[model samples]
Target: MRILHKQQHLPPLDGPRLEPHPFRAAGMPPDKSNGAPLVPVNRREHGLEARRTDMAADQRGEGAAVNTEHKDGDRQPPHGAHDAFDFRQLGKEDFEQFEALLRYAFQVSSSEMARIGWSDREMKLSKKPIFEASHVMGWFYKGRLASQVVIYPMEVNVQGEICKMGGITGVATYPEYTGRGLIHSLLAKSLEYMRDQQQIISYLCPYSIPLYRKHGWEIVSDKMTFAIKDTQLPARHPVEGQIERVDIESEDLHKVYKYFALQEHGALIRGALEWEEYWRWDSDDVMAAVYYSVDRKPLGYVIYYIENEVFSIKEMVYLNQEAKYGIWNYISAHFSMITKVEGANYTGEAMAFQLEDSEIDETIQPYGMARIVDVQRFMEFYPFQFSDPRLTLDFEVKDPIAPWNNGIFHVSWQDGEAVCEQVATCHSGHRIALDIQTLTTMLMGYKRPTYLYNNDRIDMDYHLLKTLEALIPPDKPYFSDYF
Candidate 1:
C-alpha cells in the first residue's frame, strides 16, 4: 500500500469540536503520477443560470434594516390573516427566551447537559457575553420568537489580506414556524447588514450542506481527525529550543497567533472574545505549553488535556520546524501516562508520513462553508496578483440570492491594485460567466477557475480562462472558530 502525503496551500469551539490547524509542510518529494488528477467540487448540482427575478427590485436595500414594529394589545393574529413577522435585534433582556428557544430547537437533554458539565445557570451566564457581542437577530410572529441567527464580526486572512467576515451561528426556528421561510428572511437580512458593515464574506458550520447551498454557501475547508496510539508517536527530534508550560491567558500566545494568522491564508484574525472562546475548557484539565528559543522568544504553543489515559490535543501551532519539533518532544515526554493521542488537524496534510508507525486511524471530514455576501465589495478589496501588471477582464455573475452581485462586471488591474466595476454595456462574447457560489469557492482557493470551467460550473473562452487562473492566487481558508 502506497501512502500519498499531499501538501496544500494554507477555531475553536467545543460546540462541535471543529478546530483549525497550521499550513502543511512543503518541499516533500512530489508524487510521480501521470499528472495531477482532476478533482470534482463537493457540492450538490444546482442551476447556475437561474436568476431570482423577485429580488431584482430589492437590490438597493442593502443598508436598510428590517422593519420591526411593536404592537400593543394581545399579540395574536386574526383568523385567516397572515402573521406579520417583525425582524429585530435581540438584547440582554431577551436572553432567557433566546436560551429556551435554542434549547428546545437543538434538543438539549438533561443527561447530555450534565455530561458536558453545563448547568442552566452557567449556560445562561456564559451565553450573555456572546449575545452582547454578536449581532443577534430574531423573527417575531404575533410577538413570539419564531426564528433567530447570530452574526459575529470577524476578520479572516484571505491570501495575506485581512478581510472582514461575518460568522453566522445559533440558527434555530420553532417547529410551529417551520417551512414559513422565516430563517431565509433572517439570513437575507443578515447578509444585508454584513454588506453595510463592509463584511465581504460570510461563513457558517452547516447542519445540512444541501440546504445552505440553496442560499449560496459552499464548502471552503476540511479537518482531519487523528487517533494515534502512544507507540505511534514520533520520536523527539533535537532542536535549539526549550518547552515550558505557560498560562492560558499569556499575551505571548496571542502574539504568536497574530503572526501566524498574518502569514497563513484562511486563518482567523482572532479578537479577545474569540481567544476566550478558544480556551473555554476546564482550566484544571487543560494545560498550555509554549516552545521558546535559547533567547526566550516564543515560537509555538500547544493546548492539550489528559483524561483516563487518553491525551487529547485541542490545538498545536508552530512558527518554524524547530518549534514544531520542540512541541512534539514535549508531547512525547508524556508517553508514560497517555495510552493514545487524539486531535483535529485542519491543514489537510498527512500526519502518518511523519509518524514512526505509518498506520494511524485518521478521518477527513468536510468542516465549514463560506459565501460571498457582496461580490462587488469583495472584489474591491480582493488582493489580486498579476504578473503582467496591466490586465483586464469582463465577466457576468449570476447571483439569484443576492441580486446586487448579478450582471456584468469589468475588472482591470492598474497602479498596483485591481478595480472592479459594474458596466452598463460589455461585449457578450468577451464576458466570462459564473454563478455566485462557484465564484466564492474559486476566490477562497477551495477550487480553481479552470476546475470550475471544466466541471461545467463556469463558462469562459480558453485563453481568457488561463488568464483568469493567473490573476487569482490559490488560498486555503482555515476557519477553526465556530460561532
Candidate 2:
C-alpha cells in the first residue's frame, strides 16, 4: 500500500475538569451548524476553512507577555520606536475594540456570524467570561487596540508533577503596526506575567513552527489520525466494565478525565476556563459514553457522534487497558451502523499495533508546540531522576524571545529536591548545552538527549549524554485536545 503524509491548518486548554459546557458562554450558538451541516470532527473548523486556522484561534483566548525580553538580535523598530505605546492588561471596558481586532484578524465575517446564530447582544454577553478567565493584554496606539496576546492560567501533568502552564493564544498585529516590535513587547510582557503567576511552562498551537521556534517553543506532541473499515475493527474484548451513553456534559465524563489527567504524563488540567476552550466550535448534539467497572467506578469514556455512515471518535481516553478494550467494544458494536471509523491518536505512536488488523490507514503530523517560559522555575520543579550523592546538570539555554532564559542555568539537587539557579559562568562540571527549544522537548519527554545529540542539536560529551538519558523519563507527551 502507498502512503502519503500531509499538513493542514487547525484550531485551541488548562484547568480542573470543569463540568460546564466548553465555551457555552462564549456565544457558542445552538445546533445551527451555521447552515453547514457536515460538522468538522476534532478541530475540523481549520480543515473546513483555509489552512493555518491558528489565525482564527487569535479570535479566542491564545496570546501573551511583555518588553523585557529581547530576542536573539530580533528587535525591530516599531512604527515609532521612540513613541510611547500603552502596554497593559485588558478589561471589560476594552472588550469592544478587543472583539473588533480579533474578528478582523481571524476574518470572522458578518455572514459567518449570522449563519452561526450569533447577535450583537449575544456577542456582548460573552465578554464577561472571557475577561474573567483570560489575561488579555494589548498594545494600544492612539487609544486603538492594534496588537494583542491572551494567556490562560492553566496547569499540566509532566511525569506526575503538576506545573502551572500558560496557554498563549489569539496573537495578532495589524498590518500598519507590523515590524514595530509590538508583538515582541506584548509577548515579553505576557511571559513576565506568566512568571509572576508562577507559570513556568507555556503551550500554544503554532500557526508557524519556525516562527514560534524563534521564540524558543518546540514541538511537544503530535496528532495521529486513523481510518479503519468496519471489517478491520477489533473483535470486542471481554471486559468487566459496562458502557453507558450519557449527557455530553456528564459529570462522569469530567471526573474520569480528572483522574486520568492527574495521573497521565503531559495531560492538561482542565478547569472551567479550559472547558470553554474545549467545546468552542462544537455542536450541542454531541454524545458521550462512559465506561464504569462492575462496582460502578468510571475508568474511561468516549466522546463521539455518528454522521453520514461514519462513526467519528471525537475523543477516546481510558485509564487502563481494560477500559481501552471496553471503549473499543462499544465502537465495534456499531459496525452495522457505520461504514468506517475515524479518530485521532495524540500519543505520537501508531494505533495499528493494538488493532486486530494492522493494515488500516494512519497519518502522523506535528500537533502542538511548547516552551520553558521560566527556565529556572521549570527545572526547579521538574522531576529528574536523582543521581547518587547529589544530581547536578547545567543548561546553557538560548532563548530568542524571553531573554531571561538565555544563559547558563545551573540545576542541582538540594535536600532531595531539584533546585535550579542561573549562573553567570559555566564551571568545570557535568554540563550539557542546548537552546531553549531542545531543552523544552527533552524535559517534556518528547525527545531524548541522545536523539538530540545524534541530530546535532545538542552540545554534550558522551558521559553527560548518558547521565541525561537516565535522568529524563522516556515517553512522548499525550495531548489530544486542541486549544
Best by TM-score: 2
Give the number of the best model, judged by lDDT: 2
lDDT of 1 by residue, 446-483 (tens): 78877887677776554455556656765576666665
TM-score of each: 0.81, 0.82
Model 1 residue runs over 4 Å out of place are 1-82, 281-284, 387-389, 428-430
* Candidate 2 global TM-score: 0.82
* Global CA lDDT computed for model 2: 0.72
Tens-digit lDDT track for model 2 on 242-267? 99999867888888888777766788
lDDT of 1: 0.71
| Pairs with backbone N, CA or C atoms under 3 Å apart (clashes), candidate 1 | 11-480, 11-481, 12-480, 12-481, 266-478
